[model samples]
Target: MRFPWVDYVVSGEADLLIGPLCWDILNRGRDIPPADLPFGVFGPAHREAGYPAASTRDLVPRAVIENMGDLPLPDFSDYFAELNASLYADRIHAGLPMEFSRGCWWGERSHCTFCGLNGGSMTYRQKPARQAAEEMIEMSARYGSSRIEAVDNILATDYLKKALPRLTALPEKLAIFFEVKANLKRHEVEKLAAAGVRWIQPGIESLDTRVLKLMRKGTSSAHNVQLLKWCRQNGVRVSWSLLWGFPGESDAWYAEMAPLLPLLHHLQPGPAVRLRYQRYSPYHYTAEKHGLKLRPAVSYRYVYPLSERDLADQVYYFEDSEDDDVGGHFAAGSANRRPGLSAVAKGIDAWLKAWYEPKLSMLSMRDSGDEIIVEDTRAIAVEREHRVRGLAREILLAADEGSPETRLREQLSGTNVMQAEIEAAIADMIARKLIVRLDARLVGLALWHPYTPIPPMTAFPGGYFDRRAAPLGTSRE
Candidate 1:
């Protein structure tokens, strides 16, 4: 009987005990009998002799490598040498996945209901900023690959002030991937671009505030849209999923959000998917509490012909008893139940089709000294020229990317643009689709160039972090 490797111990087939648990038991000299070895560990264990047992959770913490310079370089040259050179066509260099952190910082607080990505642990730990940056440079140099994917669940906010400056100083601009919160500031997005982080998986799960609150994502719909706009302006490509499915959600929420989708045609679009029940998520843990009765998904029956009890131990996906759990019977790719849910799904589909067909649209603005000339070419029929001077020009220029109403007032500190004029201008622009008022912040939708191309959309696209290497002006080949 083994101790911690309880699967082997449970089968009553192992002759020796190993792993941390066994070592802890032997080291402590505990009085656990051999017959009752696998009590706490998962699954049923059979009894046998000649094996040891332990029940200690004394694992060492992850070490912070202060100077990664001292560590041995990972050897991948031999591995890369075996690959065909033809496979490397049209690429700057091969890519590699790397990690600088573990668990998730946000999961420690309000864990998203449908997320199981963090497993049992939510203790956020990260490498020191300088060590992390240097290691990235070293690894990329050693492997001769410029693409580095940081598989952290969420980027540590401290990295912006700490690691990003050091990363910007690297001679070769390496392509870096990160998972970020959607409520990033405009300056933060700019810094991310400067630091060579060109790709991100910001969790913009839903564009409806009610759905967001139900999932406990701690971000609003406006905030997610703001991120998409900033990502476009700062040249960062966002890879995200739009998921719908939550207990106690109304159909009205989706219907209201659908009409606003066309206004964001210039931004990147992602596929709409149903909320799935995962094993380690809050939804799975408290399914019954939330009026959800779960059975192992249909695929599990084919994989395991055993009893339901046995299958429950192996399967991760589950089918809830309530068919109308999300948006009143929205299932898989089809949404036939409620009109509102169907409208929402259809809106997302249209957005993706527009993006795929390259139905490019933009409202461009230029500061020609005396006045700001605006050209509107959005999907809306009014694709014409408009000129703004004086206070309107000041406000639009100040809020070229985005600004809070309070900050707009602060920026116009010296100008005589009265509060009434600014308010009227903002309202007019929003009505004209030249600018969008998201919550308390106003963002100008116009780009510097007309027909600004939406970056190639992919569920997962690969590229280097250097801005020059981005698929900005080029088509997906």
Candidate 2:
């Protein structure tokens, strides 16, 4: 019953260490010596009998359990049974959390400068498509649920082409949630929706192109916008965040983008937050080289009440302060140096406020007879009722939940529909914001809203994961 962040400060004297941080160390100890191997301690042990802290950068060989099918299926029946009868009943069934993959493929290349989720395990591996489909089906049947929450660091590319088709063939639809990169095409998004992936957490950290580049997110502002557009088109709910405070970023970018915020009103809005430094992130390991001055967050000082050295050993997060004198970092400037940042923040707040409004969204459509009527109320508006017919109407309905141009054309086969008509419909739809085109694919610009009303939760607020009241310093044999 020890908290890793707090207990690790004193638990260094313990006889054994476990969990992911020490997983490779224990497995490879017999095969490779610690010094010559890619895994193990980078410094001296904390105490006379204790093991040194595990290295997060080690590229040691992972155990055979890399294939998720070999693992035991988790049981959530007991928890669900209690939850159903309790006051905390009103909640979204986002489904049971599971993993189909391990580590991040991108991290092995240019890792997002602020992320450390993969830690030492940068090698990517996934359960086979058939195995993954079978596991989800089994879990749904066992738990009487039709949803799965995949906890993969990032959705493996193979899953898009392989696993999706297998899942689509399942007898029942399972609402699967995923974390995806922002550079996906419209067809890929439609495939995910067709395969029962109802939601995604696309890591679109910033919309400012320069800030994105500074963070090495390997994506552009336009690319992020397209992803959001496609997600809405595919009836996929996207949960993302807007982050700022990069070491080498300039405030000018935010200023330039603020006025354009209204144009994005048709899409989902994410909260704007300051960036946080985490353990094993590029920012944490190479702060000095990036012109960043790192220190523990102020809250940690007040919460832990421990010496800085002990806090440093256990803490996995940091606060960055740029030196004014540093050349790459921002220097003291006119008071208006951050006007653009504030403007952008204000725009985001307004966008979020509009997002929750009862009658508004990026786009909402209704199929009416032979003509498709569109209400474009995004940043730029078409106040009049925009309409289209024939091939355009057919394409809109087919792509209401997103479809590739090729898929749409294939669906129109045997009909008198021609390629020129399809292409013209796509062009008109894009101009009216009735649909979004990405990577030569098109998705209808409509957000999916659930029709059923959800039950209210009880007044009491609690969850099983509330570890704040758990007693510490307990030992287990």
Candidate 3:
């Protein structure tokens, strides 16, 4: 009842209303018959059975389409027309937003604690693989845009194995982007890059496995690192964020992980921000269970001069009592702000700055047939090259996607390399910052050589987009 004066608040089923309810309201007066309304179209104002519509939460969602293959391609003629008429016309390389699926497959099984995505019902659905690929290519050609970013929560698993293969053979070079899971194998990453997937957002919130576990992001720090390594090695760019303020996380985890950030200067670094309470997130649905006391976010009090009950019912963002106001919220602020978090935040800032320098930091591990060459230029004066031989090289290669010490030992056992030598090699690599270990998992951080020459795949290439975003005209306004 935020606006009790209004008669109806249409929540969902825009499709159903197109020919019926909309026509009724447009042609006739504001007399919409309840009998003709579709499911999720009407609800009681107070969760009961009556007239005035209820909030989106209290109402049932409209029927979802089983197969989204029949869904028509989005018409961007109006958007482009308006953009062309503006001062910034023809300058903006508009990335066409496409979709292959609805709801996250991972979320259907295990939802991320802080993410309120896919609504309450996390039912995974996707179009036929061949159909999806055809639609993407059609859209790209139709819109005259090479970059097509998928709007799906998490990319459909089938799309990678089936759909992406089709794109690899396409005549035009498409720069596609998708939101993927972090536990991507080396081969999977290779497939993505080969299929012209130029960018990805893997949703890597924290590097520490403990912190990751706390967020229910079934991924380890090593897994995250390997993804970065492979992405950098290929021409693919990675977009991720560092989030803190989970219930059971420790500052100690960041302390262990922060000092090692300099070792990863060659890789991309995401902004570190604290978690915010979203409407349907686990933290919001079960606040007391997670030891969080939520209030209707401090700013909402000023925005809407309503009672606590009304405020709670209205606002989507809620803040925990334990949270600090200075660097709170999901902005590009707050480098975690705590003890170890301070170091991590600073490291990320440093990493971001390093990318813009005249001579960028280089840390690449190239594997020749017989030996491996590891060159380190991350340190100012410690520009050195090390030739890896025998078991050490094998260990590094084996730890491509990051592996447990025991698993690596077992995998290399047939090589007749002693356990002592393997341990020493791993420890030495860790000490030298060639590979990092978090909770016994080791992920080697280094770049690989791509087939073609491309600019360094650094995160947020300072002023690159800004320069590109400049108007394509002589007049400067």
Candidate 4:
């Protein structure tokens, strides 16, 4: 029951507290020892130029809490307020940002060949669905904004099912964003569309099945394609996370993946596809346990030699051919370029600013001036969208009523939505936090029921009853 962070906030022992602000406020002014409060700084400068008060050396202790500096510092209240104000300003100019969870779940199972998280040793368990929704609501309130980007490694399927009802009950204006595993089931997709989930980013690490298997991904390329198709059918917008440069991966694998370009085109395109290079980091415990060969941490001075294939592959994506050189591994065109280091640095800076200091972009539908147009040319289109939304709402509402049959029926009925239209609607709803789809079940439902008073919407917002009511007297024969 006793929360240490709350104690620190209450006892006037902390100046700046990060992580979940609600927990800090809830336990404020408790009797506890003053502790070091961790803060996440933004700006390309912070990551590139580095913080003057702290270096990478000082980062670990501040983050760990126990190792906080004992020296007197600035007034806690003013410092925190300024920091928050700065973050708020950033959001206003950048984009609404939200972090659902951190670290990878699979870290506990098998360390991916190219993991960077303390060799994948430090894994953080996911917050419960209810707790996550509460935090999301609080964050939305703080920003006076409904849009959120969930910067989680992967949004777990069960969490989606459990949290859907609570999320659906939130004020019907908040929109949520998050990423998830690609192999979600059909019913889960329907549930998500109903709940009001808006933006979905799936980690499609590779298109090569062999490469996927080597990465220990528990999904197949076929599953990835299917998930994309489902998103298109149900209305989910996808921002794909791709990885390149896995060891032993051949040019043939890249060639095999080339065919997937058209598939990417079929999915809704927002930001240009983010392609990342695989950086190998050996975690002490995890690598040893997995029988992975541990590489000694290299100093900044050491440079690895790249083969002809590496050079050729790197050039394929590099926009400027002129940048290719022997020392070009850390070249300007490399996707791995650090923030504030090159032209790509601008993109990173923009991302951090948009993420931390939320900015509304055209890509975000809430900021659009035009009313959303629903063109139901086909009989199935209208019926499918309405049915899916209705069933999703039933399942969501059933959570409160505690009717198992209603929940099951709601799920079974919703899955009947036409594949293409359902995918499109689900994509749109997922981006808005109206619903969340995971593994073919209505895992989590946001409170965007079609009924009036929006029924005390809970999780996030952006629910509207403007949708054309119930397929206008049955479809034309």
RMSD of each: 6.9, 9.9, 4.4, 16.5
- lDDT agreement of model 3 with the native: 0.73
How well does candidate 2 score on lDDT at residue 192?
88
Score candidate 4 by lDDT. Answer: 0.43
- As a whole number from 0 to 100, the lDDT of residue 378 in candidate 4 is 21
The candidate maximizing lDDT is 3
Candidate 2: residue 419 lDDT (0-100): 73
- Which candidate ranks first by TM-score, i.e. highest? 3
| Per-residue alpha-carbon lDDT of candidate 3 for residues 317-356, written as tens digits (9 for 90 to 100) | 8888776542374333444555677677778779878866
**Candidate 4 lDDT for residue 207:** 51
Name the candidate, 1 or 4, with the larger lDDT value: 1
**Candidate 3 TM-score versus the reference:** 0.87
Worst 10 residues of 4 by lDDT: 359-368
Q: Write the per-residue lDDT of candidate 4 for residues 289-391, one digit (tens) a residue.
A: 4343422222211432454444322221222122232222334455343322233233323433443222211111111122322222221121212223443
**Model 1 alpha-carbon drift over 4 Å, by segment:** 1-78, 84-93, 324-336, 368-370, 390-426, 440-443, 448-477
Choose 1 or 3, whichever is better by lDDT. 3
lDDT, model 2, position 306: 80
Worst 10 residues of 1 by lDDT: 55-64
RMSD of 1: 6.9
At residue 220, what lDDT does model 1 achieve? 78
